[model samples]
Target chain A: AQSVTQPDIHITVSEGASLELRCNYSYGATPYLFWYVQSPGQGLQLLLKYFSGDTLVQGIKGFEAEFKRSQSSFNLRKPSVHWSDAAEYFCAVGPLRAGNMLTFGGGTRLMVKP
Target chain B: DTAVSQTPKYLVTQMGNDKSIKCEQNLGHDTMYWYKQDSKKFLKIMFSYNNKELIINETVPNRFSPKSPDKAHLNLHINSLELGDSAVYFCASSQSNEQFFGPGTRLTVL
Candidate 1:
């Protein structure tokens, strides 16, 4: 079965500091990877997605993710974190079949410290 | 306007109750999906309908049924709901590539 793994359960970073969230997926083919963020009492919003072509993909809210096939990882990175960036982040791998449903990782909670 | 919307944002009911949650997408997309988010925030796909055809049906229970009236609406109906059915339900739509999600409906069983 295909699965997505978010190694970090929770991460705390000071405001304006650089941040990185690690994600690894287990799948046979080159998978469609995505990063989604959910604020408290809000829906999941797409951060970025990687399908093909460039390994580095940019997304909304100044977030980006790099799809590394060799490492089987798609890690999200932001140069500077803001207080508003505190939320739960999820890494998902889209099934390649026709339906193409997403297999999400156990989310990672981000804590922004002032 | 909300791209994708699900009615009854919060539902509290007893076990064995029958209930339905409605979903509508105004994004002009032909595909819609239902996903369940557990207490641990782990999301799993339940059902998907594209252009009024049932497409993806995960290992969901038979008690749960999805009805898509047209291309833009897909509703979820649960019969004799169990305790395990308590979770946040999300409605989503997709066009050529990207998928759009709605504010989830949180269901609690007492």
Candidate 2:
């Protein structure tokens, strides 16, 4: 079955430190991958997406992700962690065909330390 | 201006009651979808509509029905709500690959 996995249920990083959140996907064909973040009491906002070309995709809030086909991974990375960066991050694989549906991972909660 | 919006940001109702959540997208997208987030924060797709036509329907229960009046509007109606039905419902629309999501509706069953 097609699925997305976020191994870390929770992560902590000190302010000004670099951070990386892992994501893995299981799919039969070339998949469309996406990263989204949700703050407390807020809706999810699209951080970035990987469709076709350019394995390394840049996103808002200084976030980026690289799509590694061999490992079936599309991990999100940030050079510096900020207090505001602490939130729930989700990785998703979608639409396999059409209809714009998405299958999301369980999500990883980020807790930033001072 | 909000690209995607949902009404009744919070809904609290007793079990066995029927309720509906409305979603609208101003992005001029042709595809719309409904997703459910459980207490565990696991998000799952429940339905998808393209051009107001049902395209994908997951293993959702019959009590949960989605109606799309147009390409930009989709509404979810639930009948005989149960405790397990309590969750956060999110509506999203897509023009191509990237999807825009609404603020989400938090439903609580008593």
Candidate 3:
């Protein structure tokens, strides 16, 4: 079965510091990887997605993710974290043959400190 | 304008009651989906419809049924609501790969 794993349950980062959220997946074939963020009491918004070609994909809100096929990882990164960036991040993987339905990870809660 | 929208932002109901949550997307996407986020915040796919046809149905209970009157609308009806059914439900639409999500409906079964 295909699955996504977000190893970090919660991450605390000081405002203005760089941040990285780890994600790993298990799939039979090359998968469509995505990163989504959910703010407090808000629905999820797509951060970035990786399909083919480009290994590093930039997304909205100054976020970027790199898809590494060797490690089966699609980690999200930000150069500088803002206070408003505190939210729960989810990494998902959808098989190429599975249409658009995604298998999401548990999620990583980010807490930004002043 | 909202790309995808769900009705009843918050719902509080008693066990054994039946309720419905409506969803509509203005993006003109051919595919729509229903996802449930439990108290633990585990988001899982429940059902998916492509152009008003059922494409994917997970291990969801039979009490929960999805109706897609059209490609732009997909509604979920739950019967005999149980306490365990309390969770946030999200509606999403997609053209091909990337999906747009709605604000979500928080359901609380007392």
Candidate 4:
């Protein structure tokens, strides 16, 4: 079965500290990976996606993810954390041509201490 | 304008009743989808419509039916709702690989 896994359910970081959220996927073929952020009471917003080429993918809100095919991981990273960056982050995997119905991870909640 | 939108931000209904949630997208995308987020916060795809044609239908109960009047709208109707049906339903639209999601409708069945 195709699935995305976020090993960390919650993480706390101080404001201005660097942050990283781990994501791993299980799939048969080359995966199309995505990172989405969901604020409280809000919908899921796409941060970045990795389709093909360039293993390093840049996303909105100063977020970036690197697709490591050998390890089956696409971890989200940021050099600095802000108070406003506190939210739930989900990693997803989908096929390219398939209507792109995403298989999302359980999500990682980030708490920023100001 | 909103890219994807769902009516009834919150729906509170009793079990054994019927309800429908409407979703519309103004992005002129060819594909539309419905997803359900359970109490545990696991999101799963329920249905997908592309250009008024059913493209993907996950393993969901038949009591839940999705109807797409046109390419821009897809509505979900639940018959004989149950307590387990209480969850957040999200509608999304997509052109290629990127999907734009709506604000989501929270359904509470008591």
DockQ values of all predictions:
0.63, 0.71, 0.70, 0.73
Candidate that beats the other on TM-score, 1 or 3, i.e. the better one: 3
Clashing pairs in 1: none
Compute the lDDT of residue A64 as modeled in candidate 2.
99
Q: DockQ-based ranking, best first? A: 4, 2, 3, 1
lDDT of 2 by residue, B49-108 (tens): 999999889989999999998898999999999999999999999988788999999999
Where is model 1 chain A poorest over a 10-residue stretch in terms of lDDT?
A94-103
Q: How close to the true structure is residue A78 of candidate 2, measured as C-alpha lDDT?
A: 100
- Among the numbered candidates, top TM-score falls to 3
lDDT of 3 by residue, A4-109 (tens): 9999999999999999999999999999999999999999999999989989999998999999999999999999999999999999998775346999999999
Taking the tens digit of each residue's C-alpha lDDT, what string does model 4 give over B19-110? 99999999989999999998877889999999999988998899999999999999999999999999999999998888999999999999
Cα TM-score per model:
0.96, 0.97, 0.98, 0.97
The best candidate by DockQ is 4
Q: Chain A of candidate 2: what's the TM-score?
A: 0.97
Clashes of each: 0, 0, 0, 0
Sort by TM-score, top down from the best: 3, 2, 4, 1
Candidate 3 lDDT tens digits, B1-110: 98999998999999999999999999989999999999889999999999999999998999999999999999999999999999999999998788899999999999
Could you give the DockQ of candidate 2?
A: 0.71
i-RMSD per candidate, Å:
1.7, 1.5, 1.5, 1.2
Interface C-alpha RMSD, model 2: 1.5
Error of 4 at B47 (Å): 0.6
Colliding pairs, model 4:
none
lDDT of 1 by residue, B34-91 (tens): 9999999999999989898998899899999999999999999999999999999999
